[model samples]
Target: MAEQIELHEQAPRLKSVSSPQDQDKGTSQQDDVDDTGITEASLTLEEQTDLDARRGQGFEAYPDGGVAAWLQVLYCFCIMFTTLGGVYSWGIFQDALHAEQLAPSSTLAFIGSTQATLEGLCAIPISALVARFGNKNVAVVGAILSGLGPILASWCTKSVAGLFVTEGFMFGAGQALCFFCAATLPSSYFSRRRNFATGLVYAGSGVGGAALSLAANGLIKSIGLPWTFRILGILFLAINLPCAYLLKPRPIISPIHHGAQGGLTWGPVVKISLLKDIRFVLVLIGSAVALFPLFVPPFFLPLFATSIGLSSGAASSLLAGFNLASATGRIGWGVMADRWFGSLNSLLLCLAANATSTLVIWPIAGRVGPLAVFAVINGFCAGGFFSLIPGVVSSLFSDDDLPVAFSMIVSLWAPGDFLGAPIAGYLLQAFGGPDSGYEAYRPAIFYAGGLGVFSALMVFGARVKEGGSWRRRL
Candidate 1:
């Protein structure tokens, strides 16, 4: 009797709300409620409606393997090739600036050091800028700056100050932009294939470095530094043009009730991630420390070879081999990471290899064959470390937080880079010259290897705490 009375009373209320438009809306609401179960504690109808509005702002679907995404990847390859090629080509430039230009070795070293420092240090501000203005704008500006730096450098005289401005500051700025933009783009386009995408993008650096090595070597012999640098700059601009067009941000849907202008703040996001997440901190620290020694070999390998009685051509060849090995390593490790091991495990394996190769192989590389083998091995291991870091970082943080996370990691890396080369130089000085019959590079290698080991242990501890091997899924 009570149920019948209630139904009788509710029929008039239902009838009153049952116009054609109201009926359609009511049906949709019920469907939505069924799709995501409604509880008494759930948001009010207005709140739910607002969320639906916001969800509509997101992209309908990502073009995972679309032409645009591939083009973006290609553009990234070119950008990396130009920027990292320049970084890897530092040996040739240093020699030219010292021998042909009659600049002091220490002064030229400072130029390279400054460029390296700024490249790492600028990541924070540039990443923030990318977050605000989007990657295309940041990349275009960075590309222009990078393209123009070498062109301007071609006109510089033999002054350290000139090199500092053109090579260190300007070129450094350009490289930072290129690196950040390339790294951030594919993350927005692919989820399942992110590791592969990143590997492909980073492989660009190795390819660029290797190709530029041969070209720069011949150009230095035939045309000279000025024309060589100018030509390289033009090539860089060409590569960056396509990337500038292809890189775009993923679209985000706004909740219905809130305007697009109003969004969540960074504070709550960070607090929530940090309060509950330990992986983020661990990955960040491990990556930063592991990265400390990565650049050291590339920066000093040619010098190390030359000091060991190798000719310039032979030393350059060793550098080329290292870079080529690195290219192979990136692809191999990336594929393996995506298939067998997760990103964290891949990082651990790479770091262990780096530590082992440096500690065991490099210290004993006295003979030419041994040295060449060691160079290739070291390059491969270090390349794996580099290629795996971004994937590992992504595994720890959400997409919205990735820029800030990467920025922070890059910023922390500045000190590591600033110290790595100078410390290597100091180690060389402490050992007297290569003529002292004592290997200076041995101590430096051990130090770097030790840091790698330490980083690996940190990852291990974190993995243990998380109740899984590093190879396990996050």
Candidate 2:
């Protein structure tokens, strides 16, 4: 009842809900218990209304898996293709800036970091906007920013500072809004196949990254930098504009639990009290610490490959391999989590794989075979890590609280991303050598693996604390 009042205070709408009067109808439902000793609450009038409506209307089930849901997935894919894809593909630009413009590695790193910070900065706020004004409005504004940021960047090719503002900050902010929509909108369409849908949507990033890697490598080599930026900007606009119109949140997403309300207030205020949740705090810390290293590969892998004397063609190939594997991993791990392992366990296994690949495999990857293997494995595991984040968030909270929890999760990613690249750059500059780049990359590798392992441990601890056993759901 208190939660319902809170919801009423937040979003005033005609969303279907059981009236408080239903509780006084003298229904007794405390007798049901599940396998875990958790009592099952009886269905409320609102839920029965929903169930009957769907059944009689022959409307889609909780997970429709039909045209509407698929369209939502496609919309999310388009958003991620431009937004998260851009983030993943930044290494190509960083490499170009290093060689053609001769920017310092640290400076380039910081610029990328700034963009990452700006991108995550609005994730929490945007969730509320999506709830209030609808998803399409936020997407349109984001599409414009995403399209223009790179176009504006093309003219500033010679100036690193100028490019920083245009490419890093502008593009990052645009990506942030798109990312916000992508993360939230799909849930409105899917309930059962949500993890799979999210995996498919996130796979769009890997697809975009792989395609952009191939395109950037060829376009920059053939036509030069400015045109490449222009083309990319055009592509972002072309693809995202359609998605902006098409993507929408469904009414079905707003479900009331018992008499509790659905939908958050479409206001500026967001609940930050999860900071007090020990499990939530652990998840936050795990997210931040883990984020730092996960971004390292996207920012530096191509450069690392080239520094070790791999040709640009070979480096692009390796990066493409990484991206393809990442896409595969995104889908694979998501399937595993939904079907076999569950979210938290899948995340632990994913982190373990990433740590192993980074700590054990990467150090030995000076040659093409080893490096390619390392790249693919690392990318796959990293994809798993990214894919599981939403599931983890959803698992820790109720459905209505999902937006709040995820907002906090994505927003908190800023700090880790802002610092991750620069830290890696400095470590590399201090230790990398002319003869072999392995020595320099070692510190960053250790840093990534250590943080990943530490984050995994934190998550595991949270799991234990929440469930009191590894066997418990969480």
lDDT (Cα atoms) of all candidates against the true structure: 0.70, 0.73
* Candidate with the greatest lDDT versus the true structure: 2
What TM-score fits each model?
0.83, 0.84
Tell me, what's the RMSD of every candidate?
Answer: 9.5, 6.6
List model 2 lDDT by residue over 1-474, tens digit each.
011211222222322333344546865434333223332234566744654454333233344488888988988887887777887777778778778856866677676677678756877677766666667788888889888989999999889878888888888878877887777566556655566778888898888888886788678889988899999999999999889878766542322222224434333334566778898888878877888888777666777888789887887888788898998888888888777777777888888889888899887788888888889899998888777888777666655666677877888788787887667767877785433566678888888888888988888777777765566433
Clash tally, candidates in order: 7, 0
Tell me which residue pairs clash in candidate 2: none
RMSD of 1: 9.5
lDDT of 1 by residue, 278-333 (tens): 76667667777876777768777777787778887888888899999898787778
